[model samples]
Target: MLIGHAIFSYFPIIKGWELLVAQFNRIDPEFFWMLAAGFLAQLVDGALGMGYGVISTTILLSTGLNPAAISGSIHTAEMFSSGASGFSHYRFGNVNKKLFRTLLIPGVIGAITGAALLFYLGEKNAGWVRPALSVYTMLLGIRILVNAFRKKTASRKVKNAGWLAGAGGFLDSFGGGGWGPLVTSTLISKGRTPRFVIGTVSLTEFFVTLGSALTFFILLGVSHIETIAGLIIGGVIAAPLAARMAGKLKTRSMMIGVGALVIISSLRALVKFAASFF
Candidate 1:
């Protein structure tokens, strides 16, 4: 099932990875390449609700694209990925409109501000945000993992959890992949109902990513249309299926697995960032 999602949503990303491999015989790239990376990242993102921005932006930046461009494109691609998931949640009546409305404005503001900064960083060779992302995601992953092993667990979706959502959006825009896991986990933690938390998180992902994508295209043009189209197709095909599967998943186990995977990924990223300096 996980492999299915990976294959479905991440086909484009895998394609991009192969290209990088072809060029260098591995995953390493000399610069940013949006088409393959962004598309594939979103595929996995749609399937898993995380890793889209982080992996795509990281790989894209390797392909020689400026930080700004990679950031823009990653943000842009997320719109489609998040939209599909968000719509599904809304359809299922999982969305808490009252809480969502309260959170939307702040979420949007934080995203816009972060996106503006992301563009600037995308143009440079800095890895400043990467480590921060790595650390935060790693910690969240650990926390969830701990929660998963607990015998008596309390998972409630709270109405007053907007601050975490807003903060997660801002950090995700800056650090990457913080949106879904971070916010979803926080909601799960603060005694929010599971159904509403999942729904609210998914819907918020749609809006947050949709807004970011718009900013990217409007501000920075997409040079590779075909690649972008491929990503579009992949996302369209993967989102609904993933949502269906997500609905069937036992939330607790899924959270633990997701948390574990993210932690592994974040550790890898953190190590890489540390290595860069040496």
Candidate 2:
């Protein structure tokens, strides 16, 4: 009798649940596509420590959304995904505390500055920035690939890591994604362990992305709630798997994968930018 009474007492809550289901049903089919993109992007990012934002932004751009909306939505969704990825990496002992600490504040500051600039200045100058960054990342990718064929050596302490993180954060916020390729590639190229570099960078990304997302929210407000929700769900689901892959993969294999992904993504960006002129 008590159990029956408890169930009946929650009838209003059940009615609210039904309402929520109705709202979900009304969402556009695009949510499913975003979910797939988020899953694939997060999987790659978790394993190799880059590509989430780039992949998500590229797909979003194809839908013809404005840059502000794309950036805002991607950053918002990234907060959730990065949080999950960071936690998973920590659990796997992949994070480097010193690197995370060094990268945190500077990255946040740069991200905020970048978001503000993008809002005020728009993407008028993106043409120059995009190709330049693409070329830089492509070169970094080549360097990493070359390193993979060389004998292993002791990891070196990265020089000017703070400046690197700051620049990475700025580009990530302004261009809608570059943090992973810029930060992760540079660190790995400097002889840091690929796993730790990926892990620390992924963890730092949560805070950096949070700064950008908050700034975007203040300036643009949240427009694509369904897309964000889909990405969050997909990314969260893939986080653990990706983290495990990063931890278990061989150093050489991981470096090769990271190098290839960075090169391909950069080349794609360069090609896309060039095609715009014709």
Candidate 3:
């Protein structure tokens, strides 16, 4: 995580890596703006070991991309980002194939269904998600605080791993959030240590997201070719450094930071929802 943060902190000052200044010329004339979002997201993930997409997607959607499009596109972009991270963790033997396998079926199924639902949120009574998000945020904050104080443990019981992973993948695909920490937390609660859980969660998310991301392209025909390419390059170049840093990271400290962001994001989303009632 130290290296990851260094890479992140350096991106702004580096030249010849002008992803920061690039913008979508048409509707998003500032492509670099989105990359900046990606940069921050990755930094948070590096430092906190979670929440890259939640941060980036929220920022991206603020630019007016359809929420479904943001969900699909970010997942698509992060595929490469995730792919590498997953590979590294897999190499470390953190992944549980038997557990991850069960998730494949329901994950794909639920993702497709979720994406379909997201496509129409603008047309439906979307007002509901706000309060829901607020509640989710409030709860996430509480969860973090409690967990921070409690005796920490992760589950080693692979028995329910499949069900949990699939469910996490499904919810993450649909909401475009929660997959990483969700899986990590559940596995940890069951018996896995934070180290193995992080590795497993990061690694497995690659395949789960990759499959669903492809489906998004097939179904929605959306593309962010250049942006996705940029993220891949940036993410790849930074991985080795991130891997080394993550090893030295203090887990409890990292979770508290991320938990704070999640609560803030959730509250912001919910507050927007509440304001709309007026």
Candidate 4:
């Protein structure tokens, strides 16, 4: 009580604290909504090894945040969530060390490059770039759905894993989300073990997310602090549970769900963009 009184004696500090509290209170609904979205996205991401960014981006886009801001915010929050998820995946022995190594450097490079491009495109010409990204993500979603039905799996030895990882990382940054949809799906379709692939992807995502987030920070600064906070908190809360659940799930079902989610999100963006024209 004495300490509290002493602190309160500084009127400026007290007022600032009060103002911060008030601002937070005003955004409580939005914060909790973001939190719930983050929780679900991470749960799915952890279980199936993808979709957190895409799901989160869809939610933010629907709220009218610009593409750059949305990507930046999602990447920023993912830095924390991915780290947590990766650790959980590692603990569960879901990671493939070799694959993880092969994917890491290229993925980081791709993510950083893509982040720069996204910011550049956003600044120079945001009008069409966002829609194009939306379309691309939609296509990826379709591909994931197709993979779900294809029974023929390739040899586990992949010559293009690095390239595929690079592509996935690039798209993930450019489209605000695509890493899992592209890389994980491709690897699994090529005969990689679903549990191991999911775990490895989740683990690799930590570095990829960090690079993208840092790039976003350097280019765009911090735009959605509250959203990031919410996502990080909710994602961390769900990470362990999702990691445990990943091994139990069937691959086909996870693919179908991811595909459906991607389609819905991308379609929403496209529709909204089209509506703006008419």
Name the top lDDT candidate: 2
lDDT of 4 by residue, 1-278 (tens): 88877877875676888999998778768889889988998998998877797678768877788766777788888899899999999999999999999999999999999889877776444345557766766786787778778895455687878998888888778766668867776676566667898899999999999998898888889977888899999999999999988876687777677667667767876887799879
Candidate 3 vs. truth: CA RMSD?
8.6
Q: For residues 112-156, what per-residue lDDT tens digits would candidate 2 score against the true structure?
A: 988898889887764467788889999999999999989974678
- Could you list the CA RMSD of all candidates, in the order they appear? 10.0, 3.0, 8.6, 5.4
Residue range with the least summed lDDT across 10 consecutive positions in model 3: 21-30
Question: Candidate 1 residues 1-278, lDDT tens each?
Answer: 88978885867777878777786654223222444554456555544567666676666655566565555556665677678767876775667898788667777766766666666765332357667767877887787777767775674545556676677777667655577667765665554554566667677787777666666666676764443554455555666665665566676766665677678788988887789779
TM-score of each: 0.74, 0.90, 0.72, 0.78
Candidate 4 differs from the real structure by a C-alpha RMSD in angstroms, to one decimal, of: 5.4
lDDT of 3 by residue, 1-278 (tens): 89977887766446524554453233344466666666666645543446767677667777777666666668887777777776765665655666556555655565555555555553244345335545755675667656766676443455665566666665666566656655555454444445555665666667777777876787677666656655556565554445455555666664555467666766776676677779
TM-score of 2: 0.90
Which parts of model 1 are misplaced by more than 4 Å? 1-44, 58-66, 120-126, 156-160, 191-195
Backbone clashes, each candidate: 21, 0, 23, 0
Count backbone overlaps in model 4: 0
Please report, in order, the local distance difference test score of every candidate based on alpha carbons. 0.65, 0.91, 0.61, 0.82
- Ranking of predictions according to TM-score: 2, 4, 1, 3
